[model samples]
Target: MISILFLIAVAASIITAIMGLSFLISCIWEKETRAALYAGLQFLLMLGLVFLLFYLEATAFFETATGRAGLILGLVLTGGTFALLTLRIGSNPQALQGTRGLMVGNVKRYDERDIVFARNRTLSPGLEQYQAYYELHPEHEQYDAARRKRGGPLGKPGSIDKPQDRPNVAATLASLSIPLHLSTPEKFNPSQHPEFSQQRVELSPASASARIKGYTLSIGAKLVGITEINPLWIYANRGEIFNENWDDWGREIELTHKYAVVFATEMGFELVGTAPHSSTTIASMANYASGAFIATQLAAFIANLGYSATANHLRHYDAALVPLAVDAGLGETGRLGYLMTKDFGPRVRLGAVTTDLALIPDNPVDIGVEDFCKICKKCAHCCPSNSIPLDDQEAVNGTRRWKLNAETCFDYWGKVGTDCNICMRVCPWSHANTSPHKLIRTLITRNRYSRYLFNSMDDIFYGRKPKPKPAPEWARFDE
Candidate 1:
């Protein structure tokens, strides 16, 4: 019995030490210095404990009556505890179910003017568009005025706006704006060239979809999905400034596209891990530019094929991206109110090309994200603005889900001079998709018990409120 017990202890220690070493190595390879340091310390502590256990066993401590009794009691207690945990958190038999009904059934269409981005862009104090908007929706006047007083994102002297970082951030924004210049009817309308419009190429739905997906991937899209355009996803009116000379400033936007090709561009983890910093803003703008470049090229490609296509990217979006992305099977809408992909979680920027091309639509997937999100409140706990909800899903806009406080979130962005990404930084799913993390993710996707276990383990390993990592060395500049 003593020999058996000694072997069991040795085996358990070896397994734990191996896991610790693996995690330490992974952290080092990922350049997570803080995490690596912690992992190293943990590994050393585990080794020390294992050595102490071996010493106790080798010294014949368990041969004495009291020592033998104590050893038996310890083994029994440990085994019983593990058994209880296993029974209490056993894997569920059912696969991931559709939670779409929670947010889609009886949903009310959202207005573009009500969106924070639209409001911020249109609410300059002495502008005609501003006055018109205020006259139409008087309730928003006070809040809009207050935000204006605080100054706006990036351009203002705020918490994260270092003088040295401003140029890089501005350059990224400038690059993003260039694509918006091309997002006009003059650019989208193939009819402007009668010869090009006259030559039509016919292809099957499957072939066209494959071509579009392949082209998008070739042009740097991390993920792509096609879906039939749902009218409900389109905005009721044009609230953004699309064209300066266009007569229809706030007129209704009529998107007659039959298909929508949505795609995502990954935001670098190193930059995004910096959270509410200048580096994060730079990454955000860079990804937005990538999305814009991909969407515009794809739209032009379809137009050249004699099919009408319009790129919906940064500074020009006719539809809500999250819903379209969800419908297109790119990802599910996470509790953080961002599209969570299997590879990158919410660490992605979305772009779409709405076109008249016939294509096969991808079905929405059930990858246990909904269930995992239900148990994981790490994002909410780590939010600097405390804008994320801590409770269960609630009904908002006739749909049941975790509704974010967009007002507070945007306000925090203005104060910080960057989009505060604490939620994104700390999401367990946002971890690098290396072997260890991937294995855990697979287990998480397989069962509800795994979700709880992983969530708890993640909290223990990487704190519930993990601090933002420092910006990369290359990102630093002389102030």
Candidate 2:
């Protein structure tokens, strides 16, 4: 019995030491010096514990029943505590009651005209739409005008920061030009064929779903999901930018699609690491471009199959991407107002293709995003503009959720000459998908206690305000 307890103690210490060592190595490879230092100390402590246990077992202490009993009790207590943190025990993470566990209210369909991006575009005094909109929403006129004056219209030449303006403009134009240069001769005419592309192509929902998902991945989409179109996810009007699509701005957007194929493309980890910098903008645009390609190609493919499909990308959006992503089972909405995907978190750009094609729809997923975000407010702490809310989610748009201060966030973007991704960069879920971090994600996704455990671990290893890394060589213009 004494030998058995000694073996257990030594084995547990060894296992812990191995885990610590793995984390230490992972942090070092990821260039997280603070995390690596913490991991190294943990490894040494476990190693010391192993040696102490072995020494005690070999000494006169093992001969005493009281000493043996005390050691056994300590091991049991410690092991049990860790087990609770690491294992589900009796918890079901998917049985999530999404908001503080008592979820409430139906989300109403949002008006595209009301979004900050639309408001910013309409702020020009020369635009007739600007005068008409401000007349109705006079309360927002002061702040919106201030945002334009203070921040100077979000990025590059107009902002307070200007050194990287050339590189930022270069990166942005590369993405903006995709739609103009990368299209086929064929196009959708909303006034003409509003439903089926030409003729209906009958296909079973399951097989169509499988084929579509496979093709989306093949076309560079990192994540793809299908959901029956939810009216609430669709926009009420055309308000993204001044374009010829509508007779005038804010025209009612009438999308008659029954299903939406939502997809996301991953942003480069190293590039995103340089948040609030030109590099992150480069990363953001790169993925947005990729998403545009994926969405357009999927739309074309479906159209070829004799189904009506309208691609929604950054340049031509007609819906709320995050909610559509959520309904598609891709992820849940986090407090930072981004879709928290299971594998990639919010470190992705979204695109969608709404169509009349029959496909199996994915049920919404609950990967403990709400539960975890409740504990890990790292994004809120790291946000330069204080845009993300640190408190519990409140009712917004008729649903209980966190609403980011769009005005302040966009204004900060103009100040920095980039859309600051400090929130996404510092999130624990934003860690590289390496073995140790993957394991951590799985553990947290399993239960609430595990979420709390990993959340603290993230803060301890990676500090509350994690430092940003420098951009990759290719993205650096100064050099």
Candidate 3:
């Protein structure tokens, strides 16, 4: 019995020490200096404890009947505690309750003009468009006025502005602007070439979906999915900039596409980890440009194949990309109000192409994100603007989900001179998709118990509020 107790103690110590060392290495590889330092300290402490335990055992401390009984009792108590925690927090008879009936039926279609991005874009105070919008929704006039008075456009001087990062931010914005021209009606019109009309290619839905997915992957898309266009996903009206030839600028948008191809591009982890700083905006714009480029190429490819297709990207989007992405089996809508994919979480920018071409639609997946998000509110707790909700999902736009305070979120952006990404930066799911994190994600997707265990472990190791990482060397122009 004494020998058995000694073996158990030694084995436990060895396992804990190995885990600590592994975590320390991961933090170092990911450039998480603070976390690495903490991990290193933890590994040392674990080693010290193991040495102490072995010394106590070598001294024959457990040879006495009382000591042996105490050792066995301690092991049983520890094991029982862990078992109780697993059963209480990890066991869920209804795994899909959080996401199953959410937005399932009778979802209220959202208006594009109601989005904060559209509201900010149309803030040309005193202009006819501006006045018309304010007159239609008088409640937003005061909020819009405040946002304009702040005068902190992207890359400009404001609360979180870094002069050294302005050039990179400006370059990112410029690159994204070029794709705006390609999103207009003029580009949507099919080619009038003599042979173009007769060059129609026919392929099965499965074959076409596979080809499109492969091509998108080749062109730098991180993820891709196909889905039939749901009318509810389309905007009720146009709110962003539009060409003069399209007379119905603010009118209800009529997108006659049969299918939608949604894809996402990765935002660099290092850049995004900078949160409200210029590096975050630089990453955001960079991914937007990449998504636009991919969507435009795919649209052009379809057009050349004698089919009508319109690219929906950063500058011009007719549909809510998140819902389209969810329906296309890309990911689940997370608590942070972003599409959380199995691979990248919310660290991706979405783009889409709407076309008349037929394609097999991918079914929406239930990977336990909605369930995990219910318990893991790290993003909400870390949000600088406090725009994310802390309570349960409520009914909004006919769907039961966490609704973000868009006004406050954008207000913070106006003050910061960049889109505040503190929530994204601190998200547990937003960790680098390496082997260790991938293993955690695999467990998280499987059952409720793993989600609770990983969430607790994540908070302990990475902290409930992680500090922002420094920008990459190239982006640090101050040096």
Candidate 4:
């Protein structure tokens, strides 16, 4: 029986080492090579301890009365410690009611232009809005004129305009300008089509929502939720589509849809670490493609079942996705001013499909992430353009949240020829979803004390501002 017990312990230890080796490989593949090395070292250390155990049991070195008792006690203590650590797995972020009262009255209404700073000269030199903004903000006059004369980021005198760079610019422009086919509501009147079901076949709203979320996730979504249509989330008019003469609050932007199904598709970490490069853009487009696939498929499924649904994908957005995602319980807004889902943090792209279907509504979750963001400004510190806020949350658009300077952010992206994602790369919440990290996340979400420890530990484990790693071999070479 004693020999059998020893054999069992040896078997278990070997199994653990194997598991650790597999996890280490995954970490290395993710470019977390240091973490992988640490895991491997820990496994070797544990294996050495296991060898010591076998020598003690076999050689009778620990079989004397005192030695045997000491051996038994040590074994018990080790088992208890292992059990404690093992128990710290599979944590779920708590679901709490988010800010509920009416939006603050003192909040300032920001012009859509404030979110983005553009060289006024890039606009038609004599355009009324361009002339007025330049006159108002005179300090930008020289810089704006310089950039305008050079022709905006995409125009002549830019890097892309250089003769040798033409081929690259043309290729990129072709990809970026690919048309997203979007149909206006007026284009498809419901009365003209065959009668669609006014009600769902599912008996309960909860059941229908669960089925929809499951189906969406299985298709490609990393996270999914449904929320009631909030007027605040809908822009008065689509900004990119109607840049000039944007009608703000004058035109009614009502949706025939009553509910929105918000979902996110994760952009793998290794791909995002190479931001401001083609690899990063590929990762971004991959997420967008995945999101579009799932959203459109789900919408088609709903339509086939007789309910009217429309997929909001990529540049064809009718309503803002991030705010809708936050309100839908898919995630909380992070310091970078993007929705950070529990699993993927800010390292994912979002899509939404709004419909009139009677689906269960998800409450916006307040998982202490706001409090966590207060102490953790890793993203702010790493932001290339200093666009992310380092200060406390302030009232913006009637809601209390951190608002990033979009103009500076976009300008940085244009300069790099890629969307710089240093903020997402350095975020403490963007760590790999391992058992140890999940336990820390659970404690931090529930107790305020753990949040401080985690913030400090994260900065220590993964430097305060980690360096941008080189892209993978696969990314560097054009096949």
Best by TM-score: 2
TM-score per prediction, in order, is: 0.84, 0.89, 0.85, 0.73
What digit string (tens of lDDT, one per residue) describes model 4 on residues 1-479?
A: 45555665667677767766665665676676565667678678767867877887778766577765665666577587555534423232332443333246553322333223323322346666557656766776676565444443432343322443344445445444432322233212122123544544443677779888999989988889899977666655333332233342123445689999999988877767765555565567667666666777777666655677877876445677887887788878888988887776788899888887789998887655777888899899988799999999788767777889876776666665555677887887776676655656666656565667779867755678777666666555233
Whole-model lDDT for model 2 versus the true structure?
0.78
lDDT of 1 at 273: 85
Q: Model 4 — TM-score against the truth?
A: 0.73
User: Residue by residue across 279-383, what tens digits does model 2's lDDT show?
Assistant: 788788778778778888888788777777888887677788887887788888898999998787889899998988888988777678888998888999889
- In candidate 4 the C-alpha lDDT for residue 135 amounts to 76
Candidate models: Cα lDDT each? 0.78, 0.78, 0.79, 0.65
CA shift of 475, model 4, Å: 4.0
Clash number for each model: 0, 0, 1, 1
After TM-score superposition, the amount by which residue 332's alpha carbon in candidate 3 deviates from its true location, in angstroms, is 1.2
Sort by TM-score, best first: 2, 3, 1, 4
Predicted structure with the largest lDDT when compared to the true one: 3
User: How does candidate 1 fare on TM-score?
Assistant: 0.84
- List per-candidate RMSD values in Å: 4.4, 3.5, 3.8, 5.5
Q: Where in model 3 is the C-alpha error above 4 Å?
A: 1-20, 41-100, 186-197, 242-246, 477-479
